[model samples]
Structure formats: structure tokens, C-alpha cells
Target: MYIFRLAFIEAQLTDAFIQFKNHYGFEVQVCNPRKGNEKGSVENKVGYIRYNFFTTSPVMNSYEDFTETLRVQLEKDRQRLHYEKEVLIEDLWNEEKKYLLELPVEDYPVFKEIEAKVNKYNEAKLDNTLIHIPKASNYPFIYFIVTWDKYKAVSPDGEILFEDFRPYMNKKRAIPWISIFKDWIRKPRAVSYSRYKKYLPGRINEYLLVEDLVVRKERLIEIVNLLVTHDIKRINEDFYDLITGNNENPFGLDWNEYDALAPTGGEQS
Candidate 1:
């Protein structure tokens, strides 16, 4: 069942009523007149009824007697002139009943509580951040989960931030970049040997001479690309085997020969 709080404006209320009727087969039930849009006509009538019928009447002797007196006065005012309409309000309401729609089987949707867990990182990981919070923490530890592209973590005080949703389940896990790099280099591709020279310490580059320029420049890019993608743990092993004669290759030239070649004209500085 869906529930909506009505707006105060007459046009807005009318439009909302129409939408509610069309979408959920429900009619507006005016229970608390003060809470709903009390039109000028209704307001004036209320004032008139209170002034003429209740204020002028004699004070009651007891609280119960006063309640009964007010009820009688209320009925008497309903029979009196109803301000703008110039007719009894009860009669007008009876005629207006035909325009009201039937109520729906279910109530309108209302606001409800949402549960979200906080992670050890003090962030809400939700489902995408490669972290998981414990099921037990799903209740007490949960404050709220916010919806972005997916659910994100929120603080107990309703503050939303990325850091609050840290992964609670896998606290000590580390991603191995070196192992990732080694796997990437095994694929077939053109190689360049010079790409890593710039990345090497400044001391290492200073020691490299003109004789080592060609081998360092050629096919180094392909090798670097391989190293970057493969797992870091296996990078040195892969680099050594590729450069030394230990591994057979179609390109029979050794690393020294490769480095001695002149730089390709279009190669980057």
C-alpha cells in the first residue's frame, strides 16, 4: 500500500487527488480539516459557526455537559447558512458525495525503515566495492544504505561517504600487482627495449652508453607493456628469461645487440 502526504495548495491537492484516483483507485478522505487544504469557504464557515452558535450559548456546568453542548451547537451550525454557498453545509456535502472516488483495497505506500551495515573501514561497501560485511553486522552495525549506481554506506547519524563502507569480511587481503604483470607479458607482441630505461633510476640511465641505445629503444615498449600487465611477483623472472639466452625466441638477437641498434625515427623521446 502506498501513502502520500498531500500538499497545501488547492490546485496541487486537486491534481494529486486525480493522480491518486487514477493510479491507486483511492479517494481523498478529509479527516483532519486543519491538515488538509481548508478552502476560504470552509475556513469562513468554521469561524461563523463558532461565533454564532458556540460563543453565544450559555456556559456548561460540567466537562461532559460542555461536550454535549458543543455537539448540539455543531449540529445547529451545520443547518445554518454555509458562508459562500448560501445553503446548509450538510446538504451541500450530500450532493457533493457523488464526485468522490471509491477507496482502494490497499493503502498508499509510506516511508519505511532501511537497514545497512557498516564495514571495518568505516565505509559501506554495499555490493560493488570488492568487500563484504558480516551478516551479524547487517543489523546492529547497520545504519543506512544509500542508493547511488548501487547501495553505498552511510553513517548511523545519516552521513553518507565512501570511506564509511569499508569491507568488513576481507580485512587483510592484498592485490598482487607483480603477479598480474607477469601474466600480461607472455602474450605475442612487438617489443621495444628502451621504454624501461627512462623508468629506471637516473643513475642507471646515466651509465647507459650510445652502444646500448638501439637495443634499449627497440622492442622495449612491448616488453614494458608485458611487465605492467603481468603479476609483479613473477616480473623479474620473466624479464630475466626474456632478456637472457635461457629462453628460445624467433628473434635470435641478444639484449646487447638489440640495445646497440639506432633509435627508430618515430620513437618517442
Candidate 2:
């Protein structure tokens, strides 16, 4: 029997888990409530993971790095001899893997697809985050396939519009500012009213909020250029640092009078 813990969700089994079970033709046996003894081996494995792998907090730089660390840890654990068999766990896994069913040709759909309307701002909200929909000026709506770490926006005709990495697991909102560059350039003043304007560096906001429209336009152009020329992920971290007072400008710029007050179309001295 394929034993599993009782889930608190209405379906008890997750949609993905159910799909996997159906594909493999497995009969699930859920343990009785509060009966830890029935799932003693699973509980023991959990305890082992908690004590051995999670005893201390890890420095997780990124999801990929954290997953790599976990994979390495599992490999290290498998190097040990099995408790009952007195053989290396890795060798046992080699035999066990051979008996497992071959994976299907097509991968199971683990992501949820949702239809969303592009708002007047040419953006679509997914999981509370605003994702930019390029060429959405005419397209009224798009479909977003949401996964654990990323999501893809597809047109009605199955053509991919755009895709972006989910910022985090939590419900915080984010903007893919780069994707909306053209719109922002057309309406540079709208940056003041953007949802993510609060995330901008104070120095940047101050520079862009100047009374001079020319200076503001120049600053907006510069901001777009900085985002376009550099790694967006690094720029995002720099923005965080600027927010926390750890850095001055996300772009590492010390804007002088020439940069801030320069004429729109004149040559630099």
C-alpha cells in the first residue's frame, strides 16, 4: 500500500499527488488520525531529517542552491550503511531504482492555469503580484500557468506572451518593470503612481520627483537603461540593499548636477 499522511485540505490528496497516483495505478493507504505507530518508519525518517539535515539553519542564497545542498545532504546520508541490511544505502537505492516504474513520456501537469484580464496599465495580477504583459495593449486577457518557482503568461492561441520567476513563496507583490519599459517611456510620469514605486531607491525617487520635467524624464531614461544594461536579479538585490540603507543607489550612481540638471538634447561638457 502507498501510505500517506492525512492532509488537512478538503481533497485530502493534493491534485498533483492524486494525478501521480492515478498515473502509477497505486492504492493509497492513509494512516489513522493520531496513530503515529502506524507510520513509525515515516516518522523515524522525519525525525532523522530534522535531527541530521535540519539541526542548524542553512545559508540559502537561492532556491537552486538550497535544493543542491539538500541533494548533496541526501547523498551523504545514503553513503552510510543501512541499519538492518548492513549494506550501503546508496547500493540499496541502486537496486530499488531499477524496480521503479519508468516515467511517462510526457511530464505531468503540476501547475495551475488561470485566465486573467490585462488591466488598463498593461499588467496582470497573479498570486497578488503584478506581472507585465507585453503587447497587451490590444489583448484583453491572457492565461497564466503558475508553478512553484515561476509562471508563464500565454496568449489565447497558445503562443507564449511572457514568463517570469515568482519572487517568493509568500504573497508579496512584485513588478517586472523591464517588460513595461515602452509603456513607461511613453508615460514617464506614471512612475510616480506605480505600485512598485515604493521599492525604488530613495535617491532615485528623489531624483525623479524633481520639479523639472526634463530632469525627471532624463532620470527615467537612465533608470530604464540601467535596468536594461545590467542583470535584473542583481539590480533587484541592490534595490533591497538601498531600501535597508545598506547601499545608496541600486545602479551605483552618484548623480551630479550634470546628470540631474542636464538639458534634454544638449551635448555633455
Candidate 3:
């Protein structure tokens, strides 16, 4: 049995911590109370890291990037001569690394899985990130595999339903405006109060910012349909061409020619 002892008077292994230990196949050695000698190396390393890495607060774009930079710095540090041995740390590491266990073929997923139900808008919320699920009914449940940067929503049978790479965090809504716009255009009053209104492209937003409520609603519907027809990336470019009566298609081919080239009945026409 692996024993984990904390300095707390009522120390006990948490279920989550035990599960983590089991998954990693590591045995913890616990020392008796007030026996500080057992963890001397650990204490020394913690102080060493605090002095070397955490003395100054770092401003970083992401935790993963910061970790990678720290790893590189540690590797560079290994080139220095050892204080007591008078030998390069890298030379010692080269010999030590040979005794280490080989890496596993598959990486262990370092994430927590949680059950989530699709909202009225067919979206699932996990780790404060809104994931868009297609063809999911309101209140339909899914399992969300969440990590720091990304997440995947899977069906009960393990089929992936939705996956997002750049997950929005910090109370930000990952709005699927195209779908929402379909409903909002009919009820323009709702659009004004919607949290997602701020995310709308400037051109479309300006077009819908009409003084007359009825006129704004009608224009919003037209704009939404146009956006749905083409990719969101080309929205501004296509919208400009459409309004300006430009004959050139953004794809470099006319609509009729593109449609003719499109596959039909599971095969190219």
C-alpha cells in the first residue's frame, strides 16, 4: 500500500488522490510525524525552484508556453558544473537517464470528464466554455472531456459530437451567431438584449442598427441568410461584393459554374 502523510492532524488520502496514484502506478512513501529528514530533498528542491523560477512573477500568454520555456531553461541549467562533483550536470544526467523507465506508447489523458446537458440552443457548457453541438435536442446530455485549452463533447456511446480547439473561457460565451441569428431576426427586440450581440461583425451590426425596429429586424434576417450561405471567414468580403453589385465571386468562380461542379448523388457531376 502507498502511504501519503501530510502535516495536518487529521490527514487521510482523498479518493481523488488515491485514484490519481493508482492511474500513475506510483507508490508514495509516508514518514512518521515530525520526521522532517524523510522529505529533506523535496523541501530543498521546492526552495530551489522558488528561488530560481518563482522569485519574479512572469507575464505569459499561456501556461503551456510558460512550462515549455521553463523546461528549456532547466535544460540549459544542466550545462553548468555541479557545485560538489565539479562535473557538468548534463554528463550526470546522460548516465542517470539510462536507468529511467521508458515512456509509455500512449499518453495518459490529464483531464476530468463530466456529464453536461445541451441547453435550449443545442450548446453544452463545460469548464466555462460553451461547446456547439449540431442536431442535439434541448436538454440532451453529453460527456465533456475538458482540458485547459480545448474540449470534446462525446455521446454516451463514445461518439464525438462536438470539439472545440480555441475554447472561450472567463465567462465568455462561444456564440454560434448564425443559428441564433435565425431566431433573433424574427424577434429583433430580443437581439438588443442578447449577450452575443457584442460579438457580431461590425458591418452586419451597423446594418442592423436602424432607428426603426421593424426595418432593423428585416435587414438582420437578410444579413443572417447571406452569412449562412457562405463561410463566416469570407462574410465581410462577400457582403461587400454583394452590396456593391460586384460580378466576381470570392471563390474565383461564378455561382452557376460552382454549382455545376458540385458533387451530386454521392458523385461528381
Candidate 4:
């Protein structure tokens, strides 16, 4: 009875957060911002974790890679003896495992609902970024199910029309070259006029600016295709290697297949 009284102490919580706790059948003691010391063990462990895990300044390729590395590190950390219990931390967890409840049978739904207007570009503006929605001209507005990492466009009948990764993920400061490449490839001459042209290496930009229209178009197509998988530096090195006789075809393409992409400079007689 005394334990129950202590567990039910009033604390601030959002409706969704409360729902999350209920779904997992777990108790969460809410800690106010200034009173974070109420969870002193957790707070201290954060500092300990930073000193141990981040002191080396680890680099990760992506968000998923970081999570996987952290999971492995955490499991390894669990093998150590508990500071006060004088037993393996894993053993302590094993001893308490039986008291833990199983996770809920159904997955918890997590998303923020927001109404998005279908724009003239057949895309919806989400978080002030545009995401293409197929056949969006048929509808004036869409309701997006927004999560931290992705968004989903749902129809009036709940049919999913589009699903896309958020623009900001892993690209907070990087240019979205892949997003613009498709449209730009169709108009090769417009490469110099593109906003992203300035982001390209000066040499590549200069090469594309040469007076020979057909040569510029061929080079632009090669760059756009190679850019899909390789970075600008690699593209530059490969192009230079090819021109220097070190590589037979650094673009890895059969020019015969791209005949139409580069016309015969003038109409065939």
C-alpha cells in the first residue's frame, strides 16, 4: 500500500506519453526540467556514458549504424560488475527479468497528424519542405502522418499515396543533388544555369561551359549518371583518369547506348 502511494505521485505528462506508458504496462515518473535531479542515477549515467562512449569521438556512417554500434557497446557494458551490487550487471538483469511484463501484442502508433495542401507542383508542403505526391492534383489537401524520420501521404479513404524520408535526415547542411538530378538530366544545357551548378567542382563546371554543345551535353550526362553513386571528387578523378589514358572508360558506360543523348552535332543527312 505504501509503495503504491509513492508510485502514483502527481507529475506532468502529455496525453500521448501517458498512452505510451499504458501500452507498455510500465510506470514512468515524470521529472520536471529544473528538478531533473529526481532521476539522479539516470542523470549521472548520462555523464558516465558520454565520458566512456564519446570521449574518443566516434564517427558513424548513418543513424542506423550508430544505433547498432551503441547496442553492441551497451551489451558489452552489461558484462561488467555492478558498482554497489558486487555482481555482474547482466546477472542483476537476469534476476529481475521475471518481474518484467511482456511487450504489448500490437505495435503502438506514433505520429503527428497534420493537414497539408496539395500545391501546383503536385507536391505537399510538409514542415515547409516539398514532397511529391502522385496524382495529388485530384485532391486539394492531404493529411500527413508525420514521424521524426519520415512522412506518409494518406488519401481521404486512408489509401497511402506516397511515403518519403524527411528532407532533413542526414542532410542538415548537404545539398539534395539526387533530388534535382532527374529533372536536370533531361535538359543538359541548363546545367550551367542550375542553382546546384555552383556546388560542383570548378573544373567540372568549366568543362560543361565549353562552346561545343554536343561535348558539353555528353559530359553532363556522364556526370549526372556517375553522381548517382559516387561523389564529385570521385567523378572528377575518374574523368581526369579517363582523359589521361589511365582508364578506358571511367564513366562505365557504352557510348553507343547514349547516341540519342548526344546528337550527331547536326541532323543526320
lDDT by residue for model 2 (111-175), tens: 88999988867888887766667776567888988888778888888888787676474334344
Model 2 bad stretches (over 4 Å): 1-18, 22-37, 104-106, 115-118, 135-142, 155-159, 169-181, 185-188, 192-269
Candidate 4 on 27-143: residue-level lDDT in tens? 875676577678999989999899999998789887788989999999999999999989999999988988888988887888898988886445678877766566664688988
Which candidate has the highest TM-score of all? 3
lDDT of 4 at 93: 93
For candidate 4, the clash count comes to 0
Candidate 1 at 167: error in angstroms? 33
Q: Would you list the rank order by TM-score, best first?
A: 3, 2, 4, 1
What are the per-model C-alpha RMSD values against the true structure?
25.3, 11.3, 10.1, 11.0
Model 3: per-residue Cα lDDT over 83-158, one tens digit each: 8899999999999989776655665566778898876656677657565575444336888787766677788788
- Model 1, position 14, has a per-residue lDDT of 69
**lDDT order of candidates, best first?**
2, 4, 3, 1
Q: Assess candidate 4 and give its TM-score to the true structure.
A: 0.56
lDDT of 1 at 218: 41
Q: In model 2, what is the error at residue 190, expressed in angstroms?
A: 1.5
